[model samples]
Target: MKALVTTEDSGFGLRMADVPEPEPRPGQALVEVRAVAVNRGELSMMAMLPPGSQLGWDIAGTVLRPAADGSGPAAGTRVTGLADGAGWSELAAADTARLTPVPDDLDWTAATAIPVVGLTALYALRHAGLLLGRTVLVTGAGGGVGRMAVQLAAASGARVVAWVGSAERAKGLRELGAAAVSTYDAEETGPVDVLVDSVGGQVLNRAYRLVVPGGKVIVYGNTTRSELNLPVDWGHARPGVQLRYVHLFHELPAHPVTRDLGFLVQRVADGLLDPQVATVAPWTDAEPALRALAQRQVNGKVVLTI
Candidate 1:
């Protein structure tokens, strides 16, 4: 079986290599992957993982084999799932708990984009309590998760303020439900009820200050990979403010991954949600796709066809 493996030699730290096929456990299903989504998190993981380690999370494909425990979808079912670091392979084993069946009409690229990006936005907004008639600020709003966050927040009746890195990346965000789209230097005033920040560092520090009292700031991905330095008076000045760190694995048991995935897929089918695929290419072009993502050259999810 051929899979993308971490390697120091590649510019993006990933390269295709022949590896032994995965063996599914009793609670896992073997999926013949047709498409996979590349994410910024995977690039960060490559820095910590050893060479040759399989590193991918979002995958969409057909079930080659059902879970041995008879808990998941039947064989040959089309599905989109979260992989435990081996999704880049042609065949990857996914736990039944994380697999969600996709409609036959859904494109593979769109299906593969749901797992991480959609769930992150869904869960982050859920943590913010009621969004109706509130102001929501989404940092890194041009990215995949950010785009989803903007739409979901707006759908919940919140006034969404999107913060992107540049003007060029700000296109189409307003149509997706953002009330205002601002770049890094834009002067955005007024307080927000909730903040969804993926671009860490200075953006996070600035956004946290914008959250009104009793508001929440949900931190998911630190794309900038910089240390956070908040004001020393944070505890005293902001009495009811809350800061949360959300990771999908940590929150997986709190809600059914399969159920959430189904909701996202159904939303896409109904045209209520957009996957926002920016690049679609064969797996042979993984390096360029990853590089583009890493460099912020693309504004949405990059799909690699297996």
Candidate 2:
């Protein structure tokens, strides 16, 4: 088996190497990975892991073996899942609860884009409660999660406003159902019913004020990695406003991963949702794609075909 593992190298911090095949537990299934998606979370995890550590989450593939407990899909079924790690490999042992059958209509590369970003956006929006006829603003609207958030929010009948870091990233958001797309520094005159902030720091500071009275703010990721300083009187002055930070894994226990993935995959199959892939390259090209993602050069998910 071969996998992309963390390394001490100064470049992408990852390299492909032969590794032992994973042994699926009773509640896990062995999947033959066809593709994987690059996410900021895995890249951030790279710095904390020792050399040779397996790091990956999103995977799309076929089930080589069903779980011993007879919980997961049958063998040979096409599936996409969120693995704890070792997903960027020939095979991965994924929990049955985290795995979902990938519809034949959904391409493997597109299926790879579903788990992390799609699930995160779904969960974040779920935390926002009702979105019908309300305004929902998404910051970092260029990235994978942000793009998915925009489409999902719009589909929920919310008036979507997407905020990106660059004008180049703002392209196609309107077509994807955003009412308006603005750059981070652009002035937004209207208040929103819900604010999904992925870019923290100054972007968050400003967006925080845009939430109308009784609105909700869901903070999932801080791509900017800067401190958030809110005025002391800000919270006091905003009545019924709520601020919530969603950790996908923490929320997963309450939300069925398979059910959510089924909905997303169906939407994609039905042409209601877009995976928004920025690039699809061989697994060997992962380093460059990952670099582009880290630099915020890509507008959406970077998929690596195995």
Candidate 3:
């Protein structure tokens, strides 16, 4: 199997080489890689660690085999979801309990887009009680998770007011179902029932005053700031209104876990969701895409064609 291997622990090394195929462990599934996407987590990981670590998380592929522990995807099936690492490879392993089935009609590019970003959006919208025609504002509305949230919340009957940093994205955000699209400005203000924040720091701090009383704020990823900040008093003084940080990985497998990646896969299999691929590059070109994406030059998800 050929894989993107990190040769050093620091942020700047990646080499493609032949590695042994991974065998499925009990409770795990083996996937023949098709497509994978990039995220800031991967960038930061590479920056912080030595090379030799496989760097990838979002993946969509087919189940070649499931572990003998009854983890098979009914033997073979098209599926997608989060993975531990080694995503930039021809093969990978994930717990059978974590893999989700993709829609038969969807391509791997689209299938690969939904899991991490989709789940984050799902959790945010649900936590905010998105229905009832509530007005919600999503920061970074044209990005991966933001676009999904915009579409998902709009589909659920929410009147959405979204913000993006660039004017070019405003039109698309509107097309995707934002009731209103505004250029993110610190002084801007509007009443909202929920705010799904992916871009943080100043944008997040400014968003504090926008939600209605008793409303909730869901914080997931921080794209704009490495050292994110919030006004403790921002949401504190408003009784019944609270702010909570939600990481999909942490919440996806919470205790008494009745739901997992399979839930997201079910939605995908049912045609309720799709991942938007911003760009697809071979593993050799991953670095430039990762750099551009990490720098915000790329919108939506970046997939690696294995």
Candidate 4:
């Protein structure tokens, strides 16, 4: 099978290579990957991967075989889920517990775009204890996770404030249910009951200060990759405010990832949640697709069709 693997070169650090197909374990299913979504997190760690290492995590495909333990959906079921590795390949062995059935009418690209980001947004909101009538602020609102976060939070009856880098990117956030959309540099005069910060650095610092007392700030991705410098007196000023860092991989076991993913999939099927796809390119065009993501040229998820 051909997969996008790590290369020795700098800049995106990926190349197509033929690799052995994955073998399903007792609780895993072998999937014939139809499409894969590109994420900024995977691209950021590309240079750190050993040469020829398989990349990508989110994928949508048909199950060629069911789990040996007979714990999941049957063979031939179309599903979308996360894989530990080699998700960019034509085949992947996914844990049956984490897989969610994709709706028959959903496009493979759209389905592939949901897993990682959708789960992240859901988990973050849950961590923040978001409630109806609460004001929730989502940073990097134009990105995949941010867009999902905005929609999910709004659907939960929370007032959603979307923060993006540019007005152009903020164009459709309101339609996603965001009560307000503003640039990252804009001042947030009102306090929010919960905050989801994906774009660490100054934006995160600003978001931290916007949280109301006893509210939580869930820090997930650090797209800016810069150090977060909070005020020296923050602890005294916001004594009960909780600061939590969310890493989906670490929280997968404790949380019902598959169940939550399934619910999100259903929402997408019902047109309640949109996995806004910025680009859908052939698998052979992985290089350009990855380059677009690395350069932050895409507004939402980028799916590469196999």
Q: Residues 23-140, candidate 2: write the lDDT tens digits.
A: 9889999999999999999889999999999989999999999999999899999999887688999999999999999889889999999999999999999989888999999999
Ranking by lDDT: 1, 2, 4, 3
Q: Give the alpha carbon lDDT tens digit for every residue of 105-124 in model 3.
A: 77888778777787778777
Error of 4 at 206 (Å): 1.9
Residue 31 lDDT in candidate 3: 87
Model 1, 1-306: lDDT tens digits are 999898989777888999999999999999999999988888788899999999889999999999999999999999998987799999999999999999988989999998999998999899999999999999999999999999999999999999998998898899999999888543564688898998999988887777777888899988888897677776667788899999877888899899989999989988999989999999988778888898998889999999
Candidates 1 and 3 compared by lDDT, better number = 1
- On a 0 to 100 scale, what is the lDDT of residue 161 in model 3? 79
TM-score of 4: 0.96
Please give, for residues 1-306, the per-residue lDDT of candidate 4 as tens digits. 788888887455777888998888899998999999988888777867789888879999999999999978788999999986779998898998889998899889889999999999998888876469999989999988999999999999999999998887796899999888889644753788898898898888887777777888898888888998787766788779888899989888987777889999989989999999988899776677778777777889999999
Please report the candidate that would top TM-score against the real structure: 2
lDDT winner between candidates 2 and 4:
2
lDDT minimum window of 10 residues, candidate 1: 183-192
Predicted structure 4: lDDT = 0.87
Error of 1 at 249 (Å): 1.5
